[model samples]
Target: MAEPLSSLSLWPIGNCQVSALIDDAAGLVWGCVPRVDGDPTFCALLGGERQDEGVWRLRLAGQVSATSQYRRNTPMLVTRLEAEDGSAVDVIDFCPRYQHSGRMYRPVAFIRIIRPVAGNPRLEMLLTPMHHYGTEAARTTRGTNHKRFLIGDHQLRLTTDAPIGYIDEGRSFRVEQDLHFFLGPDEPFTGNVAHSIRAMEEATELYWQSWVRGLATPMDWQEAVIRAAITLKLCQHEETGAIVAALTTSIPEAPHSERNWDYRYCWIRDAYYTVQALNRLGALDVLEKYLAYLRNIVDRAAGGHIQPLYSVMGFAELEESVAANLAGYRGMGPVRIGNAAWTQIQHDAYGQIVLPTVQGFFDQRLFRMADERDFESLESVGEVAWKMHDQPDAGLWEFRTRQLVHTYSAVMSWAACDRLGNVAERIGRPERASFWKDRAAKIRARIEAEAWSDEKQHFGAAFGHHHLDASLLQMVELRFIRADDPRFQSTFAAIEMALRRGEHMLRYDSEDDFGQPETAFNICTFWLIEALHMCGRSDEARGLFETMLAHRTASGLLSEDLDFESGELWGNFPQTYSLVGIINCAGLLSRSWDTVR
Candidate 1:
């Protein structure tokens, strides 16, 4: 296996409906057209012998190098390709997202505008879209000013101002008028290509800037928070409001380790954290959207039993399978689609589903505040949590080879009932509130009695399992146990002793279905920082937070795993969990805005 030259110089541009990842040189290295979970239209980043097939590249005939950046406060990406002879071109890429008609019109389309910025710059356009994950080429047909690609059952029309034949042949052409390309629906582009694209670019820019203005970000690291918030927002499947775990999947957690798993689906745990992170910045649109998603999910559950995850479109069944179409990321092989975790009974989800949606009952600013009907639906989820709080199932680490009454799951279940109690009161349901509060008390009492090891003087991962899991740090965050509690203090010490490796922390060092994890789980480290801050180690937490910031890619993004020793990023790209960590830690450690004024 070989490492990709595509540096994590990876940048993202999207309209809520679709997302595209571009390389530093303005090549569309990876993207799921029409939808985030849809088939990959350009998948070189996943790796194979035929990576060039699904890629879209804009080559400056004699280019030396290029530099890229997002237009401030917008998803628009610009790449300046400078040729050795001093000629250059600026390639601007964005997916139009703005208000049109009475509603938001975030089309599942990508728009690229190219213009020569320096002397006589020449350009070569190469767009080779593939189907079935690069197993077959897309059938093509040419039109007057457009080209249609028959990708699987769908027809994608690419309307461009550049000569169709010239683009198809990858021929060098002198730069003249600004060239605009829109690849989306099969419907004919109804307006002038250049004019419509220009208008879209302007509107999209204004849309993102205005969206950012609404954020109540911490005074420090506002840019990083905004970017992560925007990326998190892009993961949302707006039609149903399901938030995906990440944009790309099957990127191995560590090199050639069989850890690559599809992440384009929605996990209750992941969506909860994603919602919580964004909500902290006052991004209520996501919460309001996801709150409806949760309500629909609970409405469909049988006896209040919900799976760990679901398809972004809210489908119940997501049978896992491997795609033989292309070799895995860096040819690691066994590219997987559809996560099997969807079938697992992760008891933690009952709590995860409850935590975010309950906010609507209390928050005054929501357009459609939750009502008693919503509370009825949520009470069913709490019922499940009460029934399974101590029952065996997959824990948050999602171990496949074992089942235990995971302490984290019990803790989350406790949180679910606890918050429901608070929400029931807010909604004026005194009897329901007392019922929930009593159940929450009983769950918490059992967790303390069974999960705590008096001899070890620390909390274990499960009822009797002495193994340390980093999730113990979440106790403080959940308010289940105060950071200063002696039990929590000892559990925190135990986790650091058992899992911490220098500045990094592992979720667990125990071997699982795929052997022991070699890299540090990115978010686990953030949990440690937050734990440290709450425990009055604020200076140390601040120092570690600074160190983690230095580890972010040029894009200020991170994947799921980082090398505990070398700090190399691995796992799914633009991992939602990892980005949420950045947002949370920055908020936790930054100096207060009050002193700024």
Candidate 2:
């Protein structure tokens, strides 16, 4: 049960709480609370010397073998433990988001479920929510109609519908059996105990089920697709529809590398492709909201400038800050919030942001609601698109070192102009159409003449560098160049030859790149998937797609990078952008497979 002491992740069907078992031998960590990124309340992940934050353990129980899983198509988590006494305890966990409970940036509901599967099991409940990753303790007490606790700015209110007993530990309390626990911060849940639980569960289920049904994927890989789908939905900040890169912030690319970066904000570039992927899956309700968010941002900027990323609520003032109190993930230090890279201008971001909005507008049937106002907002995007060619700033990677005329950036700049021209021509804006066409033609000419390194047989990462970048592969995807175009073919081949590591492709071979340079970028690999299909290597593309699919973790989760040697997922877990890439690539491959058959 305990392997030199480690952690295990589990999902139980029809349960909402995702449990991470810290000590299987002791059966010490049980009935865990709301979520993974939540305040540990009970965590041994941070430090040691028998120190853990908040945990409810079955203290009287001895060593046990445990397994956990979620109900099919639901967030419910059931953790099963078989004890040394031949007794079994089934902990059913769920924190149902109540009706209209999906706003991700706000404090939300979390449910814990417990049931006796095989035997009458006795359990001890302990609540210890340590502040700042268990660095500080919350003041605790029992209030009328509420078990209230506060630490600095965080206020926790626990309400139980059943009779409960409590003992105060250093941090939280130990509770008796037969109780339903409701845990949330200052943003209160509606009503008390049972009413709140029912509402939250109904809302969360409705939100999730509605999303799942909308996806067009069949049952062949249904569970995998559903898990991936939920992960993607979780990333969307429900209020603004700004899809965060991930829920957690400041997880390092490499342990002790100081390469930590905050990804909670939405990147303009990531949003574009994500929109396309969601559109392909027929998940446009959320996609349209995101597009509207982008529209609002464009209107607000008024052509002054657009950020490469923004906060979940569309706040543009995202200056990076470090949380010095909490220890970094695995000691990869400097847990940061807000991304400084927001100020860096990635020219490709403009096209990536605009094209997806346009594509989603036209392709997804859900966008049948497109009206004159939508088109007007799009015209504003065209005005912003024109700014791409004039700007020379950091390219797609948002590199901190230096800014250059990245060829991929140029390709995207060209794409924005070209897409704007298409939209303008369709909407009868002939003058605007002509202007965009002229700019597009110029971008094409500039890329062919300046971006190509005939001597190196490929396009450069940046103009005159002669180095290949994985992003140049986008030239084909964005139609900056035709798939069979000699330059594009040569560039793709060159990237495969130079940047390819086994079946995976690297972003670029920059020495300054972080994360040990051992893994392929999840997004870049997906780019290769599309590129392979475009270049008529359909079989190879399909094979690589299958291989990448195999790389997903056992729970159908995927991280930002794949360690080639050890095959460990690195960077953030359940990365939405990477999964979006998977959807786009899979949809393309599915189409290709149909064509071949």
Candidate 3:
């Protein structure tokens, strides 16, 4: 029988370096190695009908049903499979991450422990890995207790205690005892495999639980917030402190929309929102590391210019191309590898840099405080924001063929100058504060005159247009305007009437390069919820929040897009933008701690 196709109903496990997606049946479907943006070592999620090639699965003979769940407050996943004859087996999966050798030990490895719990069971281990974007199978070599797969120039070794002959020949065997498998670098295993794996599992669990314990979670929806927060952390590349937008690439925004693009790289705009959301939970570790990444980016720019996105290693050139060998999500063609948006001129990036960097000056808890030298570097970013406030460029949405002075971009530019002024004042640079505040005032006046649509009675998507966009709602969140301000209220009313589709919200109603969008962007819906709460519609906001929460997958996570009509998830898995929305909204709408105290 053929294996079933993959879906968004998957769980994520990572250690801030390498990550993988597992299906309910405990198949390792998607993962990248060396780094998040590296080659897909397990490309089964986009492998189409040929998924049996690039995947690792433990098959239970006569399998009847299966169930899976994450260990509470951690990314460790436990899956149980029951056979027709009442036989069962438990599969515990995780990537090792703990304190070892006086440093954080996070290797690019996957650990699986399988133990039979019920009647005598038979198991078939299918561990076929592919190379070069699923174009060919990985060549294999064997040892006494392990097998090595030559993938591209690198080799991945599978060190297992299971019957090596059975796994090597893809044969079914009796599950008479516990089994352990470690797939990682081609190195010798020193310690006893069983004992080392068990100890790693315990330490990894403790590491995650202790991290979660330190979070200042809200009074309500604590579980949901923690899951989302962990998912966001999984998206970050700790070595570089860069947070990616999503884990997979080329998952269409809608069925056959052809709007697929790679999302493994870090977007300045996305990273800023990620740090802002994590900061609200007092997860300053992420913020502090991200600030370091931001400082490097700003220094490289020399306060002149910055790209919208970059590779996880902070490299600039990410030439876009298609991997025709592998099929896309659900056999959709054209799986993209690198993102072209890295070259687009997204003016909002300046603000994204300044917004998060300014936090370092105010937060006293960070290990390294921002000094005058840091402020000097930030002013270079502010200068660019002031210069580009009204310049036409690609908007945050990255419209390929159009260039416009977008309202969102201009607003962010204004925010850049505005925040620089605050930082200057905090650092006792009153003269610098006055200078930036003046520029901010001028930019605000220009936006008020150009972006506002007099005929539509609302702010437009871009200057001198009457189009409604979900991003306009961000004005309130960015403090560009108060919720009660008449202009903002009118803009909100216009947007609600135009972009709201039942419980979901569209990024914009206007057609784009790919025609009209067929699915709702998840972050846009959360933006509407935030707007509703800010407008004093607490009941409406709470109800809508509940509806959104109900849309999360069994793993309590969401993707980048959703089929508003069917509520099925689409786009990439474990979207950082969507997860950030969960954290921000929960902090906003959850019951106050005073209620319980």
Give the Cα lDDT of each candidate: 0.87, 0.63, 0.91
How well does each candidate superpose onto the true structure, as a TM-score? Answer: 0.98, 0.85, 0.99
Q: Sort by TM-score, best first.
A: 3, 1, 2
After superposing candidate 2, which stretches have Cα over 4 Å from the reference?
1-51, 54-60, 98-107, 132-135, 144-146, 161-163, 166-179, 185-203, 218-220, 359-384, 513-516, 591-597
Better of 1 and 3 by lDDT: 3
Each candidate's root-mean-square deviation in Å? 1.6, 4.7, 1.0
lDDT (10s digit) by residue, model 3, range 212-303: 99999999899999999998999989998999999889888898888888999999999989989998998998998888888888889955
Instruction: Kindly report which residue pairs in candidate 1 clash with one another.
Output: none
Model 3 global lDDT (CA atoms, 0 to 1): 0.91
- By lDDT, the candidates rank as 3, 1, 2
Name the lDDT value of residue 535 in candidate 3: 92
In terms of TM-score, the best-performing candidate is: 3
